[model samples]
Target: MTVTLQLEQLSIMPGQRIVLRDVSWQQFEAILTELGDHRASRLAYDNGMLEIRMPLPEHERSKVLLSDFVKNLLEALDIDFEPFGSSTFKRIDMAKGIEPDECFYIQNHAAMIGKRRLDLTIDPPPDLAIEVDLTSKTQLEVYRVLGVPELWRYESGRLRIDVLQSGRYVESPISPTFPDLLLVERFPGFVEMAATAGTRPALKAFRQWVKEQLQL
Candidate 1:
């Protein structure tokens, strides 16, 4: 039997997160759609376990900056991609559900081009997903089940890229989207600049930096 929190009866504290065990996929979907377009909290479900969290202000800051960094890099490198910010992805048979902070289709962009709707069973999963984890760790295992190809995790002003290999994710020193952009050697400083310079100036600086790097 599936059960959910009786919000009308329960008292939840400010910034309190709620998790439910034995939640069916349908219940999770209903809850996700009910809370449509709300960015105050993030939710994830794996099999029958569901987790909800209210992100901190710093979380949003890092998320925006990190997403800006990727979009800027893609534009500078002229890569084709589609952004799916916080879209819910679930597969009943796979017993997995996720709402990524931000996701994108790059290498498989053409495959998904002009599609009216995305069905993970018939469609490919997003190539990359970004998580600015300030409150808790991401469920990479859930992503692994969903067949996500790559992940970028930022925590405490640092960034790390992980690429799916076989059935496991292996941390990589180079970005899967831009292989030439050395993640360990060159990307860390850029992350710092974004977090410190504020969004607009950091984006401007990043555009300039990418142009310079391309010229070299």
Candidate 2:
């Protein structure tokens, strides 16, 4: 059976993918707390090998806002990625799959071809999957399950970069996700740069920084 992911009684997307909706906040809290307290890690339910990612509360806002930031950046770079897909599916998927506030494909637009469920034929998990964490769940379990090569989790205004290696994830100071973007010496300030400069300005600044390093 398929489920739709929705917000406030409106369908956000359509597909056979599982989605979480219609559950009361109390019930949602109960489930999240149990998973976090007992598992001490992130958990996603799947009867088959299909991947899933779920987000915690408060993170929803964080991820959405970050999406706006990233979307603007991608546009400035002339990169192409659809902001959203299959709204009707999101409105009703009961399986409770997590949605990345923003998602994009690096290569061809043809990769989006599929029905009901997401087409995973592409490699490296769509270049990046950004998350906003408000709980104890680690990216280790989440990224592994998602089979994504790179993941960026934002927490408390800081970004933690994770790179998938040998079927597991590793935390590193540098990000393998956007190898072109360098964060030398001032890695921590990357988000601040994005925040303060705005998307286009921040991206231009990032490019300038990269050029400076190349010249040096």
Candidate 3:
């Protein structure tokens, strides 16, 4: 349940990624707490593999843009959702742990409605996870182990909607929650537009666009 490697720093794209080898579950928990209130570093642990990477300013920028867009879209559609941004999710039985860049409980919103702490043993996983992948590639295996149903991955200035099927993620042409929207052809460009527009303007523009689409 661990990768035994030295805490070596490898120079990558934006920030430093420190990889630790042979870490115990207790140590991981301690480190997470030690990291208390630090928002810029991201942590990933699967089995015994532990990776911590400091996030760049631009990374946070793109993440917020995409996050706001999804939240705004949900509101416009009048869909009840609970946003969980960068919340740690771990299952001891599965030996996997991860925190999505942003996640939402939609289809199962009612199940988790008004709740705070999420224990996978009792609470269902988020129906959709939003991942901003420009900084690094997300570990799909983590999501698979957690049994998330859908993923929205944004990378290299593009957006993709994926749905999990039979223990694997496949590129989906449209979103399950927002089924009427055609993602492959129209949504990617729209994503860029909204991200560029900033949150307030983006919400205004998105609500207008959604109304036009629904003819409301």
lDDT of 2 by residue, 9-69 (tens): 5322221123343455344535454444322123332321222244444445456555655
Residue 190's lDDT within candidate 1 is 70
RMSD versus native structure for model 3: 3.6
67-182 per-residue lDDT for model 1 (tens digits): 77888888888899888877777788887877777888899988877766668898888999998763443367788888999988887556778899998889998886788766
Candidate numbers sorted by lDDT from highest down: 1, 3, 2
Clashes of each: 0, 22, 5
TM-score of each: 0.87, 0.51, 0.86
Question: Each prediction's Cα RMSD?
Answer: 2.7, 10.5, 3.6
- Ranked by lDDT, the better of candidates 1 and 3 is 1
State the displacement of the C-alpha of residue 211, model 1, in Å, after optimal TM-score superposition: 1.7
Error of 1 at 34 (Å): 2.2
TM-score of 3: 0.86
- The digit string of per-residue lDDT tens for model 3 on 100-176 reads 77899999988987787778988988898887773444357788778899988887777788788898888888888
For model 1, which pairs clash? none
Local distance difference test scores for all models:
0.77, 0.48, 0.76
**Candidate 1 TM-score to native:** 0.87
